[model samples]
Target: MRTVRVELGARSYPIYVGEGLLPQVGERARQHLPGRRLMVISNPTVLGLYGTILLEGLRAAGWEVLLAEIPDGEEHKNLTTAAQLYDRAVSGRLERGDAILAFGGGVVGDVAGFVAATFMRGIAWGQVPTTLLAQVDASVGGKVGINHPQGKNLVGAFYQPRMVIADVSVLASLPGRELASGLAEVVKYGVIRDAAFFAWLEEWVEPVLSLESEALIHAVATSCAIKAEVVAADEQETGKRAILNFGHTVGHALESITNYSRFAHGEAVAIGMAVAARLARRLGLGFSQEEEERLLGLLQTIGLPTSVPPDLDPEALVQFMQRDKKVRGGRIVWVLPRRLGEVLLKEDVPLELLLEILSNQA
Candidate 1:
């Protein structure tokens, strides 16, 4: 297993990436604490896969384990769904010292982690991420949230996990399109930060897409390390860490405009990065056509969609972006591409320029 640590002082934890790590959850989690009830929150699809093994392992170790399975997908990321899981945790005899086990992909992690964040005014939660997107991004950062009607992730909190276990084995069961969707975030790590990592990915994207064991592990490990380093620097996105949202400002708006169904999170991000680069070039941030082409090309090579969802009103998209969390003081704080491997946060982007970008990219 490859281990990466998110150093948050008291909340510091390690992310373990390897094949068949699902069966090792009992041992890995016990290493964090002792004699606590675990409320395992997952969705039906994931529960049908690895839930039994995890239950058995913890049972064998004599830990009381309870299960709460929510329906899967981005559509379920809301207050009602979160409430059901919260209800289950409370009825399962949860205590302040007990832990909540988030046992699926990003959707599961986000809602379950939010439960952990709010349950008993914050309790221990560990991540057992099964999707590539969750393993590389969501599961590591401690930025847990549920989507509100107003926008995605509007109802949430910054609650760090006690540990994160990413089992490569579970990813094998993920359908092809879902796997491709996850790669969008993986590619984001390379685009906004590490040129060398991006180069490494250029060579390995095919192997990783093919689910070659070693390549996937290496990719997940490196992506986690990049996020960990950033999270340690800015746990609440006060400064430098905002660069991680290079594609997210517009990407989140895309998800919101589409009501989170028309496009996958990563797919929206794939398109968002392309648009942001054009905006960057417009603002003279040094990104050029070559950079935009390279990014779009990489996304296509990985089976990720680079096109914006058709029929979305450009004005409606702009209206949604105005409500994004990153926006402040009547200025959209766009995380723009200064160049490959570096991003710049610019405020007060002109309305006309942004609208023109919408027209072009849309």
Candidate 2:
């Protein structure tokens, strides 16, 4: 197993990436979580596949387990679902001393973490992220929330997990499109921080896509390490950490306008990155045509969409963006790539330019 630590002082935690870590979930939880009680929040599809193994492991480790299954999909990530989990927590007599375990993909992790954060004013939680997207991005960060009718992740908190077990072994059953969506976040890490990692991905796309052991470990470990460094430096996204929002600005808007159905989170990000690249050029941020093409080409090769849906109104998309969490003083903070390994946050992107980019993308 490859272990990457996110150093947040007292809130510090380790992310373990490897194959066959699922069965060890109980032992892992015992080490990090404070109490013996654990609520395993998952979706039906994931529970049906690995529930038996996980429950058995937890029981073997002397945990009093409470199983709560949320229906899968981004659309279900809302207050209604959170309230259901809250009801479960209350009925189970879960206490502040006990912990919660998020046992599925990003949606489960986000919702479970949100419950952990809000229930009785906050409780310990850990993440056992099964999906590639969750493993690489969502599971590592402390950002947890349910979406509001107005925007994505509009109602969330910065509650860090006690530990994260990113069992790549579980990803074998992930849908192909879901795996591709994850690669978009993995690609975001390379684009925002590591040029060499980006080049390595370009060279080893096949092995990574095929879930080759070494390539998969390296990809997940590296992505986690980069994010750990960023999060450790700026835990609350006051400054440096905001760069992690690289493709998220436009991506979140796309998700909100589409009602989180048309495209997966990673697909929206793939398109968002493409738009950000174009915005970089338009804003004279020094991004090159070759670099833009490389990004687009890589996403296309991995079966991700790089263009905004033509049917969506560009004006409407902009209006959705106005409601994004990153909006400061009503101006969206755009994380634009200056080059492959670096990005700068610009809040002054003109409305006209954004409209033009969106219109052209459409």
Candidate 3:
């Protein structure tokens, strides 16, 4: 297994990546807290897929086990879902020493982590990511959140998981759309932190889409390394961590504009990245249309959307972005890539410029 450490002082943790990790969840987690109860929070689909093995493993470890299964999808990420989970934790008699096992994709991890953060004034939590996106992006950083009626991840917390277990085997069952969606996050890593990785991905995109073992491992590991460094520097997104939001500013706005149903999280990010790249060039940030075009080509290679949908109102999207958490008080902070692997957080770019970029998109 490949291990990456997220250094957060008291909340520090490690991420373990490899295949056949489901059955090892209990043993691996026991290293941190020798004897504590585990409440596995999973979505129904994931529970059906790999929950049994993990549950049995925990049982064998002599730890109390409880299961709270929610439905799967973006629609399920909300206050209502979180409240339901809180009720389950309360009913299950979760205590401070006990931890939550987030077993599923991004949605499950987000909800489960939030539950651990708020339940009984905070309890331990671990992540068992079951999807490519979760392994590469969502499950690594401590950005746990739930969608609100007004926006995506609007109602949430900055809760960190004690550990992360990414079993790549679970990705084989992912739908094509889901895999493509996950690649949006992969592309984000290259755009923000590794130009060489971006260049490599320009060629490896095909192999990754085909689920080649080496390509997938390299992609996930590289992305995790970038995230660990960012999270280490700024656990609460106070400064450097905002660079990780390269496509997320507009991508999340689009998610809110569409109510998180029209586009998958990564799909929206793909389109948002293309928009950001073009904006970088238009704003004379040492970028070019060629870079944007190359990005679009790569996204297409993976079946991800590279263009904004006509149905979404660009102005409405902008309005939503202005309300993003990154937009402190009144001003908006944007993570723009001046070139591949070099992202800068700048607040000077006028909001009109953002509207201009959105308006030009079809």
Give the top-scoring candidate (TM-score). Answer: 2
* Per-residue accuracy of model 3 over 1-362 as CA lDDT, tens digit each: 67888888888888887777788888888986534788888888888877788889888877788888899887898888889988887888887777888899989999988888888888888898988989998998788988767555777788888889888878888998988899899899998889899899988888888877777777888889888888889887788888887888788887767766788889889888988887888788987777778777888887887767766688788777666644456566777878887978777776777777787742
Residue-pair clashes per candidate: 0, 0, 0
Better of 2 and 3 by TM-score: 2
C-alpha displacement of 107 in model 1, angstroms?
2.2
Candidate 1 lDDT over 1-362, as tens digits, reads: 89998999998999999988877798888997544688888888898888889888877776788888899888798999988887887777788888888899899999999998998898888999998889998898788898877556878899988899898878888888878888887888887788788888889988998899899999999999988998899998888898888887778788877766787778888888878887888888898788888888889998776656556677888887776544554556788888788888888788787777766642
If the candidates were sorted by their TM-score against the true structure, best first, what order would they fall in? 2, 1, 3
Report the lDDT tens digits of candidate 2 across residue range 1-362: 99999999999999999988877899999999989999899999999999999899899999999999999888899999999999999999998899999999889999999999999999999999998988998988799999898656889999999999988888889989999999999999999999999999999999999999889999999999999999899888888998988988889888878877888889999989999999998888999999999998988988999888779898888877875543555567889999999999898988888888887742
RMSD of 3: 2.5
Pairs in clash, predicted candidate 3: none
Off by over 4 Å in 2: 323-328, 350-353
TM-score of each: 0.91, 0.92, 0.90
Superpose all Cα atoms of candidate 1 onto the true structure and report the RMSD in Å to 1 decimal. Answer: 2.3
Looking at model 2, how many pairs of residues clash? 0
Q: Order the numbered candidates by lDDT, best leading.
A: 2, 1, 3
